[model samples]
Target: MTLSVQLRHGGPPLDFAADFPDGRITALVGPSGSGKTSILRAIAGLLPVRQAHVALGTEIWAEGNIHRPTRERSIGFVSQHYGLFPHLTVQANVETALIHLPIGERRKRALHCLALAHVEGLERRYPDELSGGQKQRVALARAIARQPQVLLLDEPFSAVDRSTRKRLYIELLRLHEQLAATVLLVTHDLDEAAQLASHLLLLRHGRIVQSGATSEVLTRPTSEEAARLLDIPNIFTARVDGTASGRNLRLRWGPHALRATGPLPAGIEGDLRWAILPSNVLLVRPDKPWGSHLENPLLVIVEEVIEMGTEAVVRLQPQGLSEARLQMRLPVRAVHRYGIAVGREVTVSLRAGDIVPLHTGPAR
Candidate 1:
């Protein structure tokens, strides 16, 4: 399956394009009003595209002049609210979509779909009688009753509680394993996208900011905007001052100078930005003797500590720097072990390999 779309509309332009393979989930994620849902609507034929090309498994679903209607696209779409008929029972809601088949066949298929959705016992319950999770499952069963070639989900689990959402995530994964349909999910939660999707398309201002495998995009973003959008911690602006020992490069940031392991890129000089994840920041004790360390240890004042079960986020500010702060996620036990708290002095080290150079530009 391949989807190539280019849309130009009023306000921020949607110059978005990407290709999704068969039987894999591609998540469309970004901030609110970033056109993530707009792209999904266009793919489902709910919105018109000024210029586009879309295909699914050797069939021409849409092109510049020839556009297929929503029904003809043979896609199953689940909206945020789990759009179900309040008057119809769970069984009847699913059976309605299978009305094209014979009467007995329709009943059999509807029952089978209910079984697949784990809602077989609640077939006679109406939409208002079922819980949020059950209603979502019923809606899903109805959408998949006809066996669509593609499935589009726009924050389908947002209406449910957190625990219910996690359960639905596992259910969706099992359903995908059985059905093997090309799935496109839209969500504003990056953690949800990382947990559920195999590939990710980061959208911003109605355009695709980054697209790649979930692991790659989450770890190694290409630019500063991408890193910021990904919520990467400890982003500092620095300049490549000169070369260091054994092909290492030196960088100057604020009142501190640091060494980078790799050689500087050819023809690159002047100011640059570097980012390190919170998990990569190492903690050192100020009272400990200084060994032959590669980089200088930073003296910082602990500003805040937030405990969240297994881990704690320690916010620190460099002692003499005016506008520099670093965050580290340490184990909860370690926080107490080292006596980390507000207004305490501590030493921290950032390895050269953990720092990645980032380019800056308007995300598109």
Candidate 2:
């Protein structure tokens, strides 16, 4: 099951074509001003995508001589600011989507959905009486109340704080299994994108940069733009020293030698750039016994530390690359046990499997 969409517009020109699969959450993500929202609106029939052809499974929603109005299409939309209507009670707002439900069944279904969304006690309250998380749940219940064929979420969890947002995401996953509806979720958050999406479509400048399974797209990007959008850190210029299959990449960061995983890009053996994530780098105490051999040894100074409940984020200033800083997220307990403190000197270790070589450019 798939929803195939092809779009074209006049001007400097805007065009894109995508096929969203059914029964799974597909995320459409991009940087600011990337036309992600416009594409969402087009699918909801709120905005027009001229010359656009849209088909859902066996149904033809839009094409030559076939245009279905928004009402005729069974779709549920949950926008960012949505909640129970301030005037209507939570139950009423949620059940409002049931325009054709039998009178007796409507309220019962609404209550069931509210309970499923974990807001059973909040049915009598209005939007103003609920917290941000509660309101988002209510919005969710409202959207799913009528059991629409498709669901559209536009940054629905962005309004809440980080912890609450994560909880809501967990709730969303639970609901996803219970409903198993075709979901098209839009968000600017990379972490949220990584967690909630089964398939990811990276959009940029009113176009699609890449689209594939979440793991594939996130781990292996197609271009420098896609890599940058994925936020892979510590990218640097490099060259292919030797090779066996996809290995033997020789790269350096401010005089520090490095290696990478996977095949080096074609024609980029000499003078190319590579990237690595900070989370992949391990830090050992400076006074610890030295290992027999290491590819690259970096003498880094601790710059800052941020405690976030179970996790801690550490920023560092490397010896060779004082201009380019590094950031790592680790467990709070690790820092406590190791007695890690700001201004301390430590040696960071890089594993061959951790480095992901990217296109040549200035990695920021």
Candidate 3:
């Protein structure tokens, strides 16, 4: 069943409407105080909003004067902290969600859920006795114990270590396949959202900046704000210099001229913001001669190289454009092989198709 939500609230004012597809994972991603959690709360009937119209298919959860109670809604919520009861055993915690079932059936269902969550042997242990990952698993068992129609997860893996988080990601995928429940996940990590969610909603200041298929929103953000929120670091101001060959549009950035694949935004005659993904910024290798087929090649001076284990984030300033710096990620081995360091001049290429024209005029 499709989960539809229309909410408007005061205080920090939130206003948005969206329809989450049935049996698909939709991620709500944004910075803090962006109403990711508020949307979840509003759906679960935990938040008192000024106006709300929430429904699963034709069954109304909240509309007009009617508001369904949290427990009545067929949703399972896992909070950032897991929300497992410290005093209860894992089995009892999960059993709490199955209370609507007969007394004898609850235990069996809860145990099955624990097994599905891959925490079968830990049923007797209390939440305090379990590790962070274990607690998260137990929480998942509890959430799915009643076989809810919608799963609401708020930073469910935030407390775990990287390796554990990865394992939990696999487990979540496994459970998702088995349960096939609609999931609304709230996360600050874009990578996590990209990995798990098919649809993504980018929120900022209680408003949805963009919402679309995960890959589309990540690659082709509708606005400069959305690009910035998604952490695309290669944003710069450029003026439309009219059309290039074929479908490419000419752009002038300071003294440098660039080309982007586009029918430029309608009636945009002047300066506009443009951004490219860091992954699209390629560093030309010295051993392998730069290809002539490459698009925008600019000589840049390496200003910073941040080593991130296997990969490095290199910031480069275009030779003559002191005001602009481009960020790109390269393999650590490539960084060492190229001897990429501060003050080193190197060439980087930006493909025409990779350059995305954003909002018109300078950012506010």
Scored by CA lDDT, what does every candidate get?
Answer: 0.83, 0.79, 0.89
lDDT of 2: 0.79
Model 2 Cα lDDT, one tens digit per residue, 1-364: 6777887765324577888888899998988777776776677777776677877888888787778887677688898798357899999998788867887899999999899999998888988999999999999998888787788998998899999998999999999999988899988887788899999888877788878998877876656777788887655555556554555566656677776666556665556655567676687755568775764667888899999999898888888676877777779988888877899887787777666666543222
Q: Which ten residues in a row have the lowest lDDT in candidate 3?
A: 355-364
Error (Å) of candidate 3 at residue 327 is: 1.4
lDDT of 3 by residue, 83-178 (tens): 888888999999889878997899899899999999999998888889999999999989988789999999999999999999999999999999
Order of candidates by TM-score, top first? 3, 1, 2
| Model 1 RMSD in angstroms | 2.7
State every prediction's TM-score relative to the real structure: 0.90, 0.83, 0.95
Best-fitting candidate, scored by lDDT: 3
| Cα RMSD, model 2 | 3.7
Q: For residues 87-199, what per-residue lDDT tens digits would candidate 1 score against the true structure?
A: 88889989888878999999899999889988888988899999999999998998899899789999999999999999999999999999999899999888899899999
List ranges where model 3 is wrong by over 4 Å: 244-247, 262-264, 290-292, 360-364
Ranked by lDDT from best down, the candidates are 3, 1, 2
Candidate with maximal TM-score: 3
> Per-residue error at 286 for model 3, in Å?
2.6
